[model samples]
Target: MFALITDIALTHIAGRGRQTLVSILGVALGVGFSIAMAALMQGSQEEFVTSLIDALPHVDITDEYRDPPRQPADLAFDVAAYSNLRPREDTRGILNATEAMTALRAFIKGNAVASLKVQAVARAGGAETGISLTGTDPVREALISSFDEDMRKGKLSDLRASPFGIVIGDKLAAKLTVDIGDTIVVSSTGDITRRFKVTGLFHTGVVAQDNAFGLVNLKAAQIIAGRPNAVNEIRVRLNDAQSARDVATQIERLIGYKSVSWQEANESLLEAFFIRNIIMFTVVGAILLVAGFGIFNIVSIITHEKSRDIAILKSLGFAERDVRLIFLSEGLAMGLAGSLLGWALGFGLTKVLASVKFEIAQATEVTHLPVTFDLLHYAIAASFAIIAAATAGYLPARKASKLNPVDIIRGAT
Candidate 1:
């Protein structure tokens, strides 16, 4: 019985071959676009996240808060609390860094933690550049950062071998007109001055980092910054990046300093991605809904043209439910066909996008557009298409089922 109903449905659809083809193609276009868009957006997001994770620490333990919490108001008389705010500048370096690092290592076992000092370096030729002079244990820093992988020239371990040796970015090397075996003058505002030999150069694919960042031995950096055995920042890389926020909170509670996760630092960027996803889904969904309307129009026309046939089937002992199922079957078949074709088309489009080559300024690694072949995108697109098509067919099928055989047959006679 089910086979007979499906055959009848197919025959009806075949009778209007051109209209059925058009409807299928419409749905296919919608689904294809949705799949392709999702692939590109998701791929781009993944790439962005990978770069961000590689470049930044999962959590940073800074010396002090940028803006400390305001003092509580006076309880007596419900009066506002007022205190003299002075312009005295205190040292910004972290105190007791060695003890802090030791405590942190014991607490967060199996995690990578390194100290860093950021300061300005000026050349004797009057060229001053602000650089993040990272102070690190060569072996331990490698565990936390991708510096070893991104090393263009020179060994990171060399910084340890030579106390006065420094590893600078390629862009900074160019600006300072210095190279390996060349000496550059470095000075800080605290009357700390030194001449260091450039032993190596690196490129991290980030323009800012490449332009103004350098690395040196932790002891050397402390001496250069005029803060003996002091570090301004503590960077930690956890086993799981997703657990950074929780770990950061734990660190703050254990120690009396500010701890920040990468996610917290880039909250605005994450919000932007979220909003973009919402907009993309809404636009694609509207396209699929429009395609569904095409199916509705075609099905409605078929029901009207076959009204007499429906009445004949009813008079010949066919149940109303059977008649409705036949029409619904037609819709389901069309939707299934369209979804399959759309998946193939979308896959082809994603491949084509991945093959296209392009260059972006400051993003040296992006040689081609990113297009991920994720099955989830295809599943979502197909599911939406099928649901939309089935819904469109339901209304016309219901109307046909409700028609009275007595009235339809009487009118025909």
Candidate 2:
């Protein structure tokens, strides 16, 4: 019975060859475009995220608390009003730096770097600029970030060789009119100043980092900031970057400090990506929706032309369910054919896009466009096409199943 129904469906479809072909072509185009769009969008997002992960620490532990600490009066008395209350004075920055580092290294399945950060001014001759100065151990810092790859001139090891050595962004180098071997004066909030030699220059391609950030040796930063044996931030780089969130939570629990994963730090940007994906899929669905209408038109016409045959089949003991199945089969067959053809078309388009080469306008050189070819994309595209085809075929199939043989035959007279 299924064979007979499929045979009838194929005959009806082949009978109107041109219209059927057009309908299939519509579905094919829709699926093909959808697959290519998904590939490009997902590819670009993955590339951006990978770069972000490589550039930053997977988990960052800071001296600050997630919530403000309660005042001594509030904690002791639980009173709303207090007069002439003053908090106790204490030194800032992560306390017991050596102990914390030892504890963290044992607890964490990753590399950790403790760093002192300060806001400072960099002056070279007449030109001066505000910069965020970071003090770190060069050997340890290299484990977490892509600093080695980002170095445009001189090596990171140069910082260790020259105790007062500093690495500035290439853009900052251009701004200060300074180069390697030149001297720059750095002043911190404590009004202490120190002369630092420019040992290296780095270009990370991020304008903010390149334009205003500087790196120096930990001991040198401490001396410049008038602080001894201080570290405010502990950055961790896990072997598996994806486990950052879990590790961050555990670190915060163990150390009583606020730990933040990279994902949490860039929450707003990730939300934007979510919204973009929604928009992308919505557009793809709309394309498939338009293509479904083409299938509807062709099926409706076929039903109208085959009215006499449908009535005859019904009179020959064919059930209405069988009649519906026949048309449904035709729709599904076309959908399957279109989906397969679209897969090939989409693959070709993605390959071509990935092969095209061009220079990016940014400081970094990217020769080829990013494109991901995943099987999930092909599966999603096919699912949309099949569902659209089934819906488009159903309306006309339902109407054909209800046709009365007596009326159809009498009307033929």
Candidate 3:
């Protein structure tokens, strides 16, 4: 019985060849465009997040506070009673940083946590330039950062090899007119001046990082900052990035310093990504909805044209449900065919997009438009197409099933 109904449905569709073809093509275009747009947006978002994660710490434990403490006088007395009391200046630098690092290591046993001495210094050349210096242990820092992977000229371990060795960003080296084996003088406001040999260079693919950041050994940085045995920051990487906020909260409680996760640090950018996805999905969904309307129009026309045939079948003892099923089957067939073709078309388009390449200054990481072949996108497109097609068919099918055989046959005569 089902096979007979399907045969009838196919016959009806085949009889109106042009209309059937147009309907199928409409659905295909909708699915294909949706898939292509999803691939592009999702791929670009993934690339951006990957670069951001690699370039920055998952969690940063800094000497500064998220909110500075109130002055002792303010805490002890009400504002109206002791308004003349002066506020004490907040002290800078983490006290007993080495001990704090040890406690943090024990607290987060499985995570990678490394102490770092970060400071700003004046680099003297043709002109004075301010740059950030990050003092790190080559071996331990590698576990928490991709710095070693970003090295372009020499090894990060070269900093360990020489006491005054430093690795600067490629852009920084260019601006200072210094390269490997060249010495650059660095001075801090505390009357500390040092000349360090550039032993290596790196490019992080981030303009800011590449243009103003340099790496040095922990002890050397301590000396340069005039803090002989102290580090002012720590970086952590967890097995699961999503757990960073929870772990950061725990660390802040234990260490009494500012602990911030990457998500917290880049909240604005993450919000932007969220808003972009919503807009993309809404626009693409509207395209699919328009295609569904095309299906509805074509199916409705078919039902009207076949009213006489439907009456004859009903008079011959065919059930009304069978008549409805036959029409629905036509819509389902169109959806199935369209979905398959659309998947193929979308895949080809994505491949073409992935091959396109162009260069932009200061955007070292993006050479081509990213297009991810996510199977989930294909599944979603196909599902949406089928559902839209089925709903469109339902209304016309119901109309065909409700027609009275006697009235339709008499009217035709």
Candidate 4:
């Protein structure tokens, strides 16, 4: 019985091959566009998050800005607890330099590696430039971030090595009009002025950050601030950036300080990722929805044209369900073929687009686009198109099937 129904539907489709081909192509294009958009959404999210993270410290610890961040009193251990763990290539955080060193030494106990960082602010030249100074210990700082490559000229100062050396961003250095080894009058935000040699120039491609952000030695900053052992911020580096949240929570627990992970610190940017995905899905869905109407229109036209045949079938003992099944089979067949072809086209299109790249600027290069074909996503899309198409054909198929044979065959005479 199923074979007979399929044969009848195929015969009808074969008779109207041109219209059927157009419907299939429409469905295929719609399905392909949707699948490709979904694949690209995830990749784009990752890229955006990475770029945003680069704009600030890797992870931050300070006085808890909100309700006291909870920590178990018993959770007491130094950086030594994870001596065997190594920091990955990309990691940088501002630590309370002096205190962090003391804490790290106590925690490690000569077991393995440890590091330090510091955060300070300087009112540069006058009150106009609010220079946010990042004091770093050269030996440990490289484990997390590299200001070397990001620099336009000169290099980041070694705090333990350079007495009063500083590295300003290229943009910031331009503002000061001071070159390497030139003394720049710097004042801490606390209202104190001091002279420091401009040892180097750096640029991180972010205009706002490089323009206002500066780098220096922990010792220099501490001395200038008139404090021997104090810092407002601490950066902690863990084994993996993805584990940064866990490490951030652990740091807060262990040190009794308020801390925030990269994700939490940049919540708005992270949330943007989800928002982008939703927008992409909604837009692509609208395209598919429009294509669905094409299915409905085509099926309805076929039904109207086949009314006489449907009446003859009813007279010959065909049931309403059977009539519905026949039309549904046609719809499903169109969806199935289109879906398979769409997947192929989508995959091919993604690969082609990935290779064709463009750059936004000299600093921002357009790398290959990212895409990954997911079976679940493809299946879901295919199923939706099929269901919508089948339902569309149902009402018209039923109306044709219920016609009285005499009226339909007699041509309304």
Best by lDDT: 2
Each prediction's Cα lDDT score? 0.84, 0.90, 0.84, 0.66
Q: What residue runs in model 2 are displaced by over 4 Å at the alpha carbon?
A: 83-90, 364-366
Alpha-carbon deviation at 53 in model 4, angstroms? 2.8
Report the lDDT tens digits of candidate 2 across residue range 1-413. Answer: 89999999999999999989988888899899989999999999999999899988999988898886887668888566867866665367887878889998997888999999989999999999999999999989888888878998998889999999999999999999999999999999889999999999999988899999999999999998888888999999999888898899898888888999999998898899999999999999999888889888888898999999999999899999999998888888888888888899889888988998898777356577889999999999999999999998988999999999899999987
* Candidate 2 residue pairs that clash: none
lDDT of 3 by residue, 34-141 (tens): 898999999999989877777777789998887888666678777634456665553366787777778878867344544555556646478556788888887777
TM-score of 2: 0.95
Instruction: Give the distance in Å from residue 386's predicted Cα in candidate 3 to where it truly belongs.
Output: 0.9
Count of backbone clashes, every candidate in sequence: 0, 0, 0, 7
lDDT of model 2, residue 72: 65
Residue pairs that clash (backbone atoms under 3 angstroms), model 4: 91-144, 93-235, 94-234, 94-235, 95-234, 95-235, 151-202
Q: Model 4: C-alpha RMSD to truth?
A: 9.2
Worst 10 residues of 1 by lDDT: 69-78
RMSD of each: 2.7, 1.8, 2.5, 9.2
Better model by TM-score: candidate 1 vs candidate 2:
2
